[model samples]
Target: MRSFSRLNSMQTKLTLTFLLILLPLVSVSIFANYYSQSIMNEQISDRTKGALLTTLEYIDQLTQNMDQQTLLIASNPNIVDIWKGIENPLSPDHLYGIHTVQQQLTALTNVNGAVKDAFIIHGESGNGVSTLKGGIKWPDVKKDYWFQQTIKGSGGLVVYVPTRESRNPSLYMSEDMIYYMRLLDVLSSTREPNVMVLAVDKRSFQKIIQNLQTSINMNITLLYNDGFVLETNPNSENLHKEEPFSITVKKGEWSMRLEQPREEVFKLSHILQQFTYLITAISIMLAIWIAWLVYSSISKPLQQLSGAFKQFSSGNLAFEVVHQRKDEFGFVMNGFNRMAAAQRKMIEDDYEKELRLAKAEFSLLQSQINPHFLYNTLDSIYSVASSNRIPEISEMVINLARFFRVSLGKGRDSFTLAETVQHLMYYMRVQQIRKDHFTEEIELDEATKELQILKLLLQPIVENSIIHGLEQSPNEGYLCIRSRIVEDRLYVEVEDTGVGIPEDRLQEIIMEMDKITSKSYMSSPDKPTSLYYGLKNVKSRVKLYYGGDADLLIDSQEGKGTKVTLILPMGKEGHT
Candidate 1:
């Protein structure tokens, strides 16, 4: 009894399992059935259009053939013969009299074996016949509607007609579609008009429909320009005998439609609907699984990272995150630590750089004070020497006195043009006593002489020529000092016809000298540091007193000459 009970339980569980599987399978089958039906219906609709487009393309080709036929007939001289033969017909003087012409036009149509009949009709009189070898009773032009349309269709040689009665006596009892292509006889002296019609038997159009049916099991209808039904496939219930698919094809117009049974379409749709339900269920399960996986992988890391960031935000600059896994978060934590370390080092380096710059500036200012003391001591010695009355000593002492007096006039920084030139004269006299190689000329505008300038400015510039410039030159050189006031600035130019400084070195020297002594007075503090020491010292003092607007310009060339120009403010107060 216990065994029987266990077996019953197993059977019941198996039944429930099968029920679960079958329920889902049944649902999926229904959905798939409906979906497939919808898809097939849409595909069938599109295929019908594509097939119609193809049929239209072939019809267009046939129309092209008809157009060529009309043009050939119009242009051929044989057409004139056919017209002449028909005009005076004998009893047997049937269309055969024009057989040769028809044969040529048939050859011209180029429609590959599908030429059912070819004929021409006179206008509105019903007098027309086929030109085939055996004179067939040509289709009646007056009875056929295509003939009427050809007569009325807007006067172009290229026109086409639809299915109608055959003109050939061989096929007179059967129905056929034909195109009446108009022709103009060029050979006739009177310019006689002509009409040529190419007839396609109904059998040809039937075959086209049969081929389409064999390709796909669908019903189709071919529409005409006038909304007339050209052809209908079997099983096409919606396509009425007279009513077509509202779309029309003109002379060369063509269209097609497909009709599917409502019951079959609905059955297919039911199956497709079952398939959609299955896919939707699977997609929902997948979405839930993906959500769980994302939560496991991303949620924990984000929470920990948020905590670390909070700590860092509250002034914990050295905070480091502990992440064992090597991923994007790990890389981010590493970069944050490296950036913090680099930022601290940069701050420390900036402070050290500032301290060094301050010490260097302080040392430079200390060096500038010595030159002022030397100038004052020289002035005192000059006073004592002049009082002692030693003639040559007094003369030298007097030059020294004047040089120092001008040099000491300002606060070791700047002086006026008057003071600079006074210093220049004393230095020039000293140059004559020492080397005695050059004559000097001084020209100053009255207005510029009183301008404030750097003290001892021109003395060094003049001294540079006497020492390195003319002192070494074998030939005697001339020194000319000229001053003028222009544009509210004093301009003092010292030009010498001596061995000149090279162009490349001239700008370098001038730039080096322009640095304020308090700023860069170092390396060799005994004299102003640089190649052009005197010029640099004066330029430095000028900039110091005048706040950098003042400048010393040097223009020179190899072996030609040197011109030193001083541009300074016109007043003693400040830059104007």
Candidate 2:
């Protein structure tokens, strides 16, 4: 009985050891398998991708060669002169020219094996010639959809893939065919719109790529920029099942895709998984001998690390890891202590920052209250000055009071267009008291009358026009403020028929304004200022509210005039 008990103890120890070894071995095997599978998949994908790219290049080159060949037939001085010769198809000169054009078409078809057929259709003569094996298939080119679209699509190249039965015999072998049409830049005066069409059999072009894809069992499909799939080799029905990888070349408006079957792609991985089971079985036996060693190396350290994290998650940051055995877990425990301390310090620092920030916010709020007081003070001054019975002083005081009233918007970001115009009139009236030469025209659009725009957008711009442009002009100084809605945009243009800005100074002023605008700052004493400061101030405000989508354009000619146009994106109420 004693001997039997000792044997049972030995078995239990062996099982424990085996579990320790098996756990890590299985994890390592999974990682190894995943890595190996990725490498093999990449190899398969690369080989297939290379084949598709090569095939795409060949097709592109073939089409380009076909285009050049068709151009030769369409623009041949003889062909152009033929169509211009006579309306009667039986005329000897016209018949001879038709024969010459047909011979050129036949030579083009022979230029490349992929070029199944070539065609030339003329509008004036009402005839088309095709190198279809039998004869020209159809006489009236206008009835053909390809010819009509080619004329409608301007003079650039056009591509067509037919769905219905094709008239050309070369296209009957497979439905996979493409036609390239280009309008000839014919020099003849009497010749109608001339178009050249080149038919390519995709199957014939794909033969050059068959050997390239042999290394990897992947099928390729070609696509145009507009998502039109060009039927190429092995365009099997299973394409819809798998998501394909694609490649596109810069010069061509074409994209190529490669697809592989799920079973084929995972064949090697399945083999590796079978081998993994064998490795796992062998590991269990070997593990029984060194179970105690693994427990000391991995399990104990892991237990300590797990306990520390568990405590940390439970709101107990104090995790005392006493195991000093130098290993990866020991490093982890030390890192945790440092991280915990840093997090606590960061929390304390954040609390302190919030306290200081609150004080600054309070001061900012206090500063805003000052604007409200100024409005009240202006109202008080207006009453006192108007009571004195001096019209000049009372008028100036009233305008000043109105200007301040419009400037203060009770914390609203935007004001109505009418309010903006009213503010401009108040400011302008004040200026007009001194500069009598300044004449103004308000050509505000009816549509913009009720729209909401950023407050003070037009006031600064108008002020700058009057002070700088009109005041200095040798001619009769005139200022025009016009607002209109063009499509989705709201354009507010400030025009000054005064001495315009010189070309060099105009560019400098624009650059300076851009610097301020890009910084996206409101006009403040702390920011770098501009000489054309009012314009800069207005631009900065415009950008701060609208970002880069809004535009402020300045155009000026020194002797003629100056125009500053503000374009803003419109919202339901006004500029968004």
Separate clash counts for every candidate: 26, 0
Model 2 pairs in collision: none
TM-score of 1: 0.34
Please provide, for model 2 over 1-576, each residue's C-alpha lDDT reduced to its tens digit, 9 standing for 90 to 100: 364365446656766656766899999988888888778778876765676676678777876776676666657776666655356443555666677778977876786767887776666555566778423434565656666788886666787766544444332223566788877654443335777778788666566545555324466556666454443445465545676433333228766665556666668688887798789878865675476565576555666767877887786654566767677678887887788777667766875776465445434433432355666776677678778776666677678668877677676657777778887888778777666777888888888888889777777678778877888887777788889988878999999987889999999988887775533432232543547756766666566556676779999999778899998888733354
C-alpha displacement of 315 in model 1, angstroms?
89
Question: Model 2: how far is 345 from its true place, Å?
Answer: 70
Encode model 1's per-residue lDDT on 1-576: one tens digit a residue: 474466446555655655565567656666666567667767755665576567767866766776666666666665656565345332455546556665765664455456676676554343454634334344354455454455454335533443343243233323445444664564444543346666665566556755666323345556555443455555555444433323222235655554544544346465546567667667556655654555446555555666776876685656676777788767866776687677657766875876575546543543453355666676667678778876666677678666765555544455556666767788788768766799998898887666655445576678787777887778898999999877877788999988898877887776676455433433334445556656766666566455456777888887977899988765545322
TM-score of 2: 0.41
Worst 10 residues of 2 by lDDT: 165-174
Which segments of model 2 are wrong by more than 4 Å?
1-20, 85-93, 124-126, 133-144, 164-176, 186-191, 215-217, 226-251, 266-270, 281-576
Winner by lDDT? 2
Return the lDDT, model 2, position 540. Answer: 61
